[model samples]
Target: MPYSPEDKKRAVMRLRRIKGQAAALERAVEEGTDCKSLLQQIAALRGAANGLMAEVLDSHLRELFGSAKETVAVREARDPDEEIEALMKTLRTYLK
Candidate 1:
C-alpha cells in the first residue's frame, strides 16, 4: 500500500498549487482586496491544506494497516497522546 510514483507526483502538484494560492493571498492583502474576499481565499487555502493532510494520513493508514496481521498489532499498540504529540510537532511550523 505504499505510495506509487503517481501519488508522489500528485502530491507535489497539489503542493505547488497551494504555494501559488499563498502567493495570491499575499498579493490580495497588498492590493487592499475586500476583507470578505480575502477571507474566502484564505478558506479555500485551508481546505486545500486539509485535503493534503487527509491524503497523507490516508496513505500512512494504508501502509500501516493494509496488511491484515499488521493492522491488529497496530491497533493493540495505539497511543493517542503519542499520536497527538507527533501530529503537533509535524504541524507546529504552520502555527508560526
Candidate 2:
C-alpha cells in the first residue's frame, strides 16, 4: 500500500534528517575533525538509514499480506511464513 499522508510526511522528515547528517559528516571531513567525532557521526548516519529502511520494510510487509485484493492463487503460490523468515534474515544481516 502507498504511504498515507502522515506517513509520507514522517518519512520525508527522516530523509531530510539523514541528508543533514550526511552534510555534517562531509563538513567534518573537510574541516579535519577528530577521528572519534567522525566515527560517531558515521554511526549516527548509519542508524538513521537503518531505521528508515526498517519502517518502509514494515509497511511493505503489511501491504503484501494485508491487502484484500490479493488473489487466492497468488497467495497460495507464496508462503507468507517463508517470506517473512527470509525478510527477517535479510534485515538481520543489514542491521549488522
Candidate 3:
C-alpha cells in the first residue's frame, strides 16, 4: 500500500537515521573502534531498523485486513495461500 504523506515522512526520517547509523558503523569498523562500542552501535542500529520494518508490516496488514478498507476487487484478486506464504518469506528474511 502507498503511504500517506505523514507516514511517508516518518518512514523517510527512519531511513535517514538508519543511513547515518550505517555510515557511522562503516567508520567504526574502518577505524577499528573498540569491540564493545562497535557491538553496541551495531545492535542499536539493527533494533531501529527492525522497528521500522515492524511498523511498515503492521501498517500494510491493517490496510489490507484490519480497520482500513481495501477495494474488494483488489482483495479478491489475491490468493490467500500465496499471500500468506509471501508474507512468511518476507518476515523470515527480515528477521534473519
Best by lDDT: 2
For model 3, what is the error of residue 36's alpha carbon versus the real structure, in angstroms, after optimal superposition? 0.4
Q: Taking the tens digit of each residue's C-alpha lDDT, what string does model 1 give over 5-89?
A: 9878878888998999999999999999999999999999998898887777678655544556565666768776776676667
Give the TM-score of each candidate: 0.68, 0.72, 0.73
Greater-lDDT candidate between 1 and 3: 3
For model 3, the superposed segments whose C-alpha errors exceed 4 Å read 68-86
lDDT for 79 (candidate 3): 86
What is the lDDT, from 0 to 100, of the residue 60 in candidate 3?
77
lDDT of 2 at 61: 72
> Which is superior by TM-score, 1 or 3?
3
Please identify model 2 stretches exceeding 4 Å from their true place. Answer: 67-96
Root-mean-square deviation per candidate: 4.6, 3.7, 3.1
> What is the C-alpha lDDT profile of model 3 across 36-82, one tens digit per residue?
99999999899889878877998777664535366688778778897
TM-score of candidate 3 on Cα atoms, chains taken together? 0.73
Clashing pairs in 3: none
